[model samples]
Each structure stands twice: as structure tokens, then as C-alpha cells.
Target: MYCDVTKEQDIGSLVQSTIRLHGRLGIMFCNAGVLSQSMKTILEFDLSSYEKFFAVNVGEVAASIEYAGQAMVKANSRGSIICKASIAAGLASDRNTDYVMSKSLVVALMRCASSQLAPHVIHVKIISPGPVATSALCATLGMGADDIESMFLRMFRLKNDGVLKVKHVADAAVFLATNSANSPMSNKLEGKVAIVTGGASGIGEATARHFAVHGIRMMVIADIQDELGQKVMESIGSHKCSYKHCDVADEEQVKNLVHSTVQNHGRLDIMFSNAGIVSNTTQTILELDFAEFDRIFAVNARGMGACVKHAARAMVELKIRGSIVCTASTSASSGSERFTDYCVSKHALVGLVNRQANSLGCMGLGLKGVTLDTKHIADAVLFLASQDSDLITGHDLVVDAGFLVR
Candidate 1:
């Protein structure tokens, strides 16, 4: 049953009614939200008008979870509650400040709940879908049928050899509700340190903030761009977060950065090898300039290799088993026709993940590969970094909307 999540009394009444009807709450789907249409940019936004959006989109969802989750805990039942989130949580598209801010807060709030509630037996999850053809989205965006279809197609990265529908999320929710143990926790990886390279902008920045929001005390943001790196550090605040400047392609700099992180952060927990350069050329492989290929490889391939090398060494020396996640791309699997240099570099990254996973497996450390969705990659990194995947090592977490199989 769905109820307006914003009203505390309404949420409380809904919980009371659900328990009364079903004897106990089997699951909770915290999915009430509002989208901004007319007020697209922050400059155009009225604070009072936008406050309603936050209340409905984020606040209500959190309140529902708090009330519903406490009920589930009291019942001592195994349950998984899923929340509706969006890729907007990561990407800052033009003219969507209010929507993006609300979605981003939803992610942060859900992560906080996940950590606090995990010990009790209630599982909290967020499903971040890309542009879906929902009536609400269409109405808000004021797009016609053709515009709607085109928007969906542009974001659908996966080959359209198959049909995708909203029912996919519905089915996933059903599974989370019925499953006995969706994410059973072991005490591993608790209180571990993490390093997020390039943790200053784009996907890296989002992932770093996500991890920090999840109670990772020590996070080292290694980036060559000092200004942006420092900005991220400031934005996340300096509790256990610190910034370091390092050209990942240089062996000495990589080594020094890892050393300082270990010295200061105490122990390594998760290594997010996410920094990479995109080639300026958008040409076919045969026509692409050789210099473009070298430039991309130096950063995407050699840079990643250097990161893995030093981070793994620190983990091994400290005798701390940790998970290392490298950012690969969907372009790695197929030719991006226009982005040949970048494509080949991404392909090489997959090879790096495989080889490093094999190499680190012998040392009791874990290596996981991740492909990017320009949005879900941050969430995927959080999933890998969390305590849920203790046994998942040397595996590729493809976040490309199912492109590998397609």
C-alpha cells in the first residue's frame, strides 16, 4: 500500500494500519517523490516552492523508513526495504538543481539508514534507475510521445535487442520483499580505510561523498587537480577525509601517495581506482592520431596500473585485506566508433582488473572491476565498498545497464 511519505502522522498511520492488516510488516517500499518542472534552474527556484519538493521527495521517504524499519525490527523479521532513487543523484545535468539536490539527499539519507539499521535485520536499499518512461516524468518534462521515446533511447546504453519496462523495478521490489536474506552481513570490512582517486569531480566526487556518508572514517582523495581535490575535501569536510595530489601515471608519486594514506588513515579498506583521461579525438581507430592513443593509455592504463600497484603493496604490507575497484567503461566491450582511443584504453582497463584480481587473490586481498554508467558507477562502488560483498572479489560489477551480456 502507498501513502504520502511526507506527513509524519500519515506515515505513522499507514504503518499502524499495515501492521493491523498483515499482523506485521513484511517489507517497505519507501518511494514517494515529486519532480520539478517549471522551476528547472536554481536561479529560477523559489525557496518556499522548492522546500515542498525536498519534503516530499526526500524527507517523507526517510520518515517512512524510520517508522517502518523500527516496526520490522520489533517484529524481528527478515526484510528488505527498497527506496526509489535516481541517476540524477550523481550527474548534474543542466537545469535540474532542485531535483538533483533532492535525489542526492535521498541517496545520502538512505545510506545513513542502511548503516544504522543493518545490525537489526532490516535491509535498506536504493534502486537508482536512469531515465524511465513514467507518466510523472513525461508530464513534468512536457515531452510528446516522440520526445519521450527519444529521451529513453538516448539514456538506454544497452543494445535494444530486448524490451525494458518499468515492471523490471516492480519485479525487483517484489524480490526484495519476499527474499529471506537479500544482504546478510558478516563482520568483515568494518572500520576499514578507503582511498578514492580523482575523488574531486564527476563520478569520483559522487562516490567519495557516498562512501563518507556511509561511515567510512578515513578517505584519501588522490587527484592531480589540486584545486578540485581540495574543493572536494572541503565539501565533504575534514573529519577523516584528506586530499593528496598525485599524477597516477608516475610511479614515484603513486608510491608516495599510498604511503602517506597508510601512515595517516591507519589501514586500507577500499581502493577506488577511478581517475582516467578521455582522449580528445573522436575518430575511428584507423583514423585516430597516434598521440591520442598514447595520451589515453598513459592515464587510463598506466595510471590505473600504478594506482593498483602501490595500493596493493600498502594493503599487503599492512596485512590488511581490502577491496580494489577499477573504473572501466561500456566502451571497453564495444567499439564506440567515434571514441576509438578512449575505447581501447577502457578495454585495456578490463584486462588490468582481471590481472590485478588474480594477482591480489593470492594475497588474501580482493580486487573488483566496475564498469561505469556515468551515474550508477558511484552506487556500484558504494555497493562494492560496503560490508555486503565480503565474499565478492575478483568479480566485475558491470554498471552499464546490462551491456556486457547484450
Candidate 2:
């Protein structure tokens, strides 16, 4: 249980013991790492410290992945392998050169590992958190969590002071473990521009407002409801957000929307494809309306694909490695008595996201659903690990008590 990752034998024994106990490894989370106490800049970088840092950060992580991945492959057990990376490395910083370089290498290592292990159906994912008030970070800075968070707000000039939390990081890990998806999150949302489809109301509107609070420089609300979308944009501040009329079901409109945003903003960083609608009818197999089904798919499935395709093209063409998020329902994970059209379209959306993630390393989160409380999530995971959900993989069962609907 208590093993130094720096030791290969320790890692090997740990994996062996884990398999012995659990019969198979379901998840391997390589989260252990040491931060740079010296906070050395590139000018003052030292090789001796770099070696020590590399041993733990890069080397240890590689070892853990190898041991865990091998065990999973040998057992034919498909599982999730997650690693913790930092934004200080990703975004670049003036300090912590050794830490930064080590994390960068870790990213490269996991990327190769992701490709290599994909054949085995193993999900290798990275979570690049901006600044978490971890106990280690607090102790390193000799500051408390509140003080650290305050410092981050002032230092990063963050609009949302509550940007990073331990629970937030833990929640991301849970999603990756359950659904094989994660996001590259940063504390600073400043200077970022986004486009949110269906931003007129509901979850889309709420997320748009939150993005504004978190310091998005500009965001375009694309929706068919011109009046409501304009109202939400005005409420969030027109200087930061603007409303545009674009039906995602229309490929030309989606294409124009993405290209116009990039042309106007100079760069598009986040694409939140949240446009979708449920059928008025029950939509079960027996009474399924092909017309209604096509309508829903046009918006939710084909429309989402168009958004992702154009957004990715704009990002790649401009050489901007941006993030795209698709709003999918938990219903995608399972079948129900009704809303089959809505559920199938969501499944298509999920498939699109997962495909892009594998091929392009897209910044997407698998938020199938979770309850308002942590205990409910733990119970869900427990059931997932049990025989009840043995057939499930890449599934995010919504444990929310009808909150997603209500």
C-alpha cells in the first residue's frame, strides 16, 4: 500500500497485490508528484534538481503506467489510466522550470502510452489542472487554502475566484475513470473566447453566464431564439458576449458561425455545442416517429458533429489548440421507456466526442451525470464495480434524482 513510486520493485509489487485483491485492476490513477519548492526560473535552473524531479514526476509515472497497463493487458481487463498534469507547465511560467519541464515530459509520455494502449481498450487520460490548493501546495507556500485561492485570484486576474478546488479535480478523475473522458482545465479563463449553441436558455445559458464570470473575453451565443439569446447576452454584458442567429441543424449556418467567430475574435478557444431538443412524443420503439427522430438527430447528432468538425478545423488551421465541449445526456448510457430519439442522438454526440478525443486529444469532459451529493456518486461507482453493471463501459449513468430533467 505504501510504496515509493521511484522504486520499480515497489510499483511491481503494488500492482501484483492490487490484482490479487481485486481480481483485476479497473483504474490506475497516477497522481503522486513533488512540486518545486525552489521555484527556480530557467535562468537559475539546476540539473541536479531536475534529475531528482524527473525521477519522481516523469520516471515514476511511466513506471506506474507500465506496471498497471501491463497487468491490465495480461488480464485482458480494460481500464482507465489517468495522470495529473499542471497548467504551470502547459501554459508556461517564469518559475518552477524543473517542475514545468517534468510535467511536459509526462504529457508526452502519456500521449504515446494512450496510443499504444488503445488497442487494449485502455483509456489513458491526462488532467491538467491550473492551480489547486492541495495540501502539498499550501505547505510549500506556507499558506492556507483560502489564502492560496485568494492569491491565485489576484495573481491570475481571474474573474471567478473559485476556479480550482480539490473536489473539482477529484470530480474530473471520476468522470475519466467512468467514461474515459477528461478536460484540460486552467484557473485563468481570461482572454479566452467561446461560442455556445443553444445559449438562449437552460443549461447553455447558465454555462454562458458562468463563462462570463470566469473572465471569457468574448463569447457568441448562437441560437434560433434571437430574442432570448440577445437578452442573455445583454445580461452577461454585450462587451463580453454577443448573440447570433444560427440553427446547428443547418450545416452552412454552423460553418459560418464558427468561421465568423474566428474571423471576428481572431481565435476561437472553446466551443460548447449544447444545442438540442427533446421530442414532444414518448418516442419509444413502437411509436417512434421517423420524422421526429430525424429532427432530433439533425440538431443533436449531425449538428453536434458539424460544430466539432468546424471548430476543430478553425483551431487546427489557425494552429490554435483549443477546446470543444458537447452537451450530451446521461440517457445515452442506458435505455428507457421513452425519449428514445433524444437518447440515441446523445449517444451519437458521445461517440463523436470520444472519437475526436482519441484522434486529436480534444478537451472534453464526460459528464454523463452525477448526483448533487458525493455519496451518491460513490454508490454509483460501487454498483458499477459490482456485477450489476458488468456489461457497461464508456457509460456515465446519471445518478441525479431527476434534477437534469426537473
Candidate 3:
């Protein structure tokens, strides 16, 4: 039977009808959502457009959950409610604030419903997709079929593989639905929550995927690259991770990222402040531009500082012995030509880690500060995040293949 989920009566009737026909309600996938065609920024947003987007994206999903959850409770049966969300939920999109906000609200609803319905053994999971070659996506972006292929390649920087297919998302949803209660593998990081900054590509993305593989209950992958971040989320499976667009240079955005993680996941156990940017143009000390220096410090040093501050506060407030890991380069100890500002920014991380370690240690928080490859750094982070490194704090684990020594 077809039903309009936005209509309360339709949702109620659909649930009742399903139960009457099947004798029980086992699984409900609230997957219907809409994206507005108007590419408007926040300042140019129209309230009516925003409402329309939310009505289908957020309102319908919540209504389905309520109606479906009630049916599950009445029947005394275990069930899973999987909501379709987007990687956009976590990231900011240009000229698509309405779509982004609506999807973000969907994620919030899933978290809220998960907690409220846990007593009834109803599992609530959000499947957030990156970019799939769907008709809706093509239509919204006003791209032709050929343009879509090239766009994905350029957006994700894909070589030949790693393009997100619709089947990948379907597989993820099936996994979540089937294993809603218990996972097959014995995950080391099970029941823990984490936040990974710069998680769109390279080291940050690798670390997020590693955390998910280790069985982290939830991960907030924060990055400014929406498409790349979504790709990472898709690869990791949204059952374990979600992407958020965050520019670490912005302190308010960093604070919001941490606050939202804790709000959605209940507590934060690990924070990987791995976002950093280097100066593109090389300049000697005499020729260095103050603006260039400031830009590097903004993200590499100050951004990491903001992340540590908020992560520490959340850990302390919740009485969690959390681990805070920052990315420090070998340049922190050694110097390199044409990278004076980059080296300086990394050195600042070393100092920040040392001081934060001592300060947070007094409050029972762990701070350790990686880079062979992205995976090697991710492994070091995993160790620090796990019980193996519980006694280790205020230390920097450098993974640069002997570059510093050489």
C-alpha cells in the first residue's frame, strides 16, 4: 500500500495496515526525502522552501518512526527503524543550506529516537549516503548523465575505483537492518564514540575508517570537503559513521561539531584533531607574508587548540577518561626548507599537547599527540584510543619513515 508519510493519518494507517496483513511489524525504512532545486545560501534562503524541504525530509521520517515504533511496542516485537540521511547532514553545502539543514535534522531525529525507543528493543539507525548516481541527484544538480560521471570523478578524485554506487548504500542498509542488535565481529572500540577532524580525505579519512573497523559505536567525521567526506562515510558504512562539514579554522564550527557529537552519541571518548593545511607557496623567512603565516596557524595550530579545548571540556564534564590525539609532523622536531610556517605550526602542536596533557591529566583526561602514511597514523591513533595506551599520555608518536632521523 502507498502512503504519504507527511500526513499523520497516512502514516498511522500504513502501520496498521502492515500489521494487519503481516501480523507483525518487523522493519521500517523511513527513506523518503526531498532536496530543493533552489540553490540559495543561508542569507538568500526562502522560509517556504526550507519548510517544504523539512516537511518531507525531517517531518516524514520522524512521523514514520513514531508510528512504526508504537506498533513495535504494542506487539512486543523487536524491530529496526533505518532512516535514510545524507552525508550533507554533517557538511555545509554552498547554495544548499535548506537541503543540508533538513538532512542534519534527520540525523538528530534518529539519535533522539534511538534513545527513546531503546527500552522497547527498537533499533534506530541512519544510513547517510554520499553522492549516488540517482535521478534525483542529477535533477537537483542540473547535470546530464555524462556530466554526472565526470563530476563524481572530479569531486572524489577517484582513479578507476571507489565511486559510490547505489548498491553500496543498499548493502549498508541491509547490514544495519539484519544486524541491528548484535554484530558478528568482536569490535575493540565497541560502545565508544569519537570525532575525527579533516576526515574527508587522506589521514583523517583513513583514521575514521580505521575507527569504524575497530567497532567504534559512532564516529563524527568532520571535514570541509562535503563530497570527499561523504565518500568516506559511504565506504565506512553510515551505521558506524557520519560526516560533518567543518572548517577547523572556525572555532565556533569546531565547538558545534563536538557539542553535536556528544548530544547525538551521549558521550565522546576520543577526539582526533587531524586537520591541517600547509602553505602552497614557499618563501624564505625574509620573504614570508604575514597572511600566509596566519593562514597556516589558523588551521594547523589554533584549530587543533580549539578542538582540544572543547573535547577536553566534554570529557571532563562527562567524567570520561577520553583520549585526545592531535596530528604532529616530524617537522616539529626538525626543520625543512620552504616549509618554515608548516614546521612552526606543527611545533606548536607539540607544545599544545604537552601542556594539555599535564592540564587534562590533573582532570583525568588523556592527551597524546603521527605520519608514515594515513593508515600508519590511523593505527597510532587507534592504539592511543584503546586500552593499550591508557597509561600513555603527553607523548607524540611520529610515524615518518625515519625522515626525522635521516
Candidate 4:
């Protein structure tokens, strides 16, 4: 029977009708949702638009869960409750705040329900897909297949295998519903939470994707580029990844990002302060502008310092014994012409890492100052973030394709 999940009465009736027809309900999939066609930034967001999106994206999911839980309990059946969420749920968008917020709510709701319903043999699972080539997404974004593919390639750092399909989601749902054994894939980073700053593109984005493949419990990709960040989050799949807008140069934003990660995920296991920029207008020391020096230091040195400070604070408070990895260039050790400011900033980062390693020693916080296509950097980060590198800290692991050796 058809029913409007947004209406309580309809949900109730639908549940009753399903029970009557099937004698019992074993599986419930709450998949109804909506998104705005026109994009609006946070400043231009319409509250009414948020309300409309939330009614379907969040409200319907909640109602479906309520009614489904009742039906399952009444029948004494062990079943799975699966909800559809989007990559948008985890990523910040320049224009789709409403969609992002609503989708995030769905994940939060399912997490709460999962714990509460576990004892009853009712499994609550959330399926947060990447950019699936669905009619709805196509219509909402006003993009065709070619356009979508091109965008994904340009913005997503991951290898372009193909766009996610509906069948992939369906298969995932089936696996979650039936699987009882602990799969190796699911236990890679079983209970770890990490934050990847500058994760919108390049090495940061690559690290986020790598973590997802290894089964990180959750990852927050923090970057200043909202659009690119969203694409990175979507590319990695929202099931275990999210994006936050953060300018590491802004101490307050860095603090909030770390605190919010801990607040949402209980504990933070890793912090990849990988956001750094090269000077667009390189100049010799004789011609170097103090302003240019300041800008570079703000991000490369001070920004990293802020991230380390906040991440360390969170780790200490939670007694997490987490790892913090900062991105450092070969320039940290060697100087280059026309890159005086950049080299100085990197050297400063090395110093900061050294100091943090000593200061956070009491807290058992490991710090590594380190990259390459980003995949190489990601690999180093994975090791530093894992138990394998617990013995290593306060060192720079440079990846420059033998640039220094040569």
C-alpha cells in the first residue's frame, strides 16, 4: 500500500496494512527524501526551504522508524531498519546547507536508534551514498550524465572508477541486513574517528578517501573550499565521511572543528593538518613582502599550530592517545630561490611539531610532521594514525620523489 511517510496517520496506516498483508514485517527501509533544486549559500538560505526539505529527509525517516519499531516489537521479529542518507549529510555546501543539515540529522537519528534498538535484535543502519546518477540528483543539480562525470573527475581526488549506482546501495542494504559476522573490511579502522584539514583537494582529499576504504568509523574533511569539499565528501561516501568548512588560519574555527569532531564522534583518533598553500607570486628574499611572509606563515605555521593545539586538547581531555600529523615540505630542510617565505613557513612547522611532540608526551599524543600525489602522503598518514607508529613521533617524513637526494 502507498503512504505518505510525512504524515503520522499515513505511517500508522501503512504499517498496519503491511502487517495485515504480510502477516509480519521483517525489514523496514526508510528512503523517502527531498532536496532543493536551486542552490543557496548559508547567507542566502531560506528557512522555509529547510522546513520543506527536512519534512521529507528527516521527519519521514523518524516517523518510519517509530512505526517500524512498533511493528517489529509487536510481531517479536528480529529485523533491520535501514535509512537512506546522502553524502551531503556530512559535507558542507556553499549552496545546499538545508540539504546537508537535514541529511546529517538522519545519520544522527539512526545512530541514536541503533543503540536503543540493539537489545531488541533490531538493527538500525544508515546508507549514505556518494554521487549516484539518479534522476532526482540529475534534476536537482540540473546536470546531465556527462556534466556530472566531468565535475566528479575535476573535484574528487579519488580515481574515477564510475559514478555510484542504485544497485550498489541496494547491495549494501542487503549485506547490512543479512551479515552477522564481523567482516574484515568493517574492522580496518573499526572505532577510529579522524579529521582531515584541507581535505577538499590534493593530499587531504586523498587521505580522506584512503581512510574510508580502510573502514574508518568516521572522518571529517575540513577545508575552506566548500564546493570542492562537498565533492570530496561525496566521492568518499557519506557513510563514514563528512566535510566541514574550516580555515586553519582561523584559530577559532580550528578549535571548533576539533571540539565538534569529539562531540559528535565521542573521541578523535587522528588529526591530519594537511592544509597548506604555495606562494602564487614567488620572490627572492631581497624583494620579499612582509605581507606575503605573514600570509604564508598564517596558514603553514600558525594554522598548523592552532590545529595541533586544539586537537591535542581534545585528545588529552578524552585520554584518547591519538595521533596528530602535520604536512611539511622538503623545504623545511632545504631552501629554494623565489620561495623564501614558503621555506621559512615549513621550517617553522617543523619546529612547532617538535615542540608539540614534547609538550603532548605526557598525554601519550603522537605527532609527526610530514607528503606526494597525496596517495603517498595518505599512506604515511595512515601509518602515523595507526598503532604501528605509536613508537614514532616528532619527526619529519618527507616525500619529494627523491628531490632532496638528487
Off by over 4 Å in 3: 1-186, 371-375
TM-score result, candidate 4:
0.54
Kindly list the per-residue Cα lDDT of model 4 for residues 249-307, writing each as its tens digit: 99999999998888888999899999998986789989999998899989999999999
Candidate 4 global CA lDDT score: 0.80
After aligning candidate 1 to the native by TM-score, how far in Å is the CA of 96 from where it should be? 54
RMSD of each: 17.9, 15.5, 19.6, 20.0
RMSD of 3: 19.6
Per-residue alpha-carbon lDDT of model 1 for 144-204, expressed as tens digits?
6557767655654322111234665564455445531233433333476888888879989
**Which of the numbered candidates is closest to the native, going by highest TM-score?**
1
Alpha carbon lDDT of each predicted model: 0.75, 0.74, 0.81, 0.80
* Candidate 2: regions farther than 4 A off: 180-406
Residue-wise C-alpha lDDT for candidate 3, range 121-170, written one tens digit per residue: 78888777777777787787888756886777676533122355666667
User: Top model by lDDT, which number?
Assistant: 3
Q: Could you tell me which 10 consecutive residues in candidate 2 have the lowest summed lDDT?
A: 364-373
What residue runs in model 4 are displaced by over 4 Å at the alpha carbon? 1-188, 371-375
Q: Which of 2 and 3 is ahead in TM-score? A: 3
Clashing pairs in 3: 90-244, 90-245, 91-245
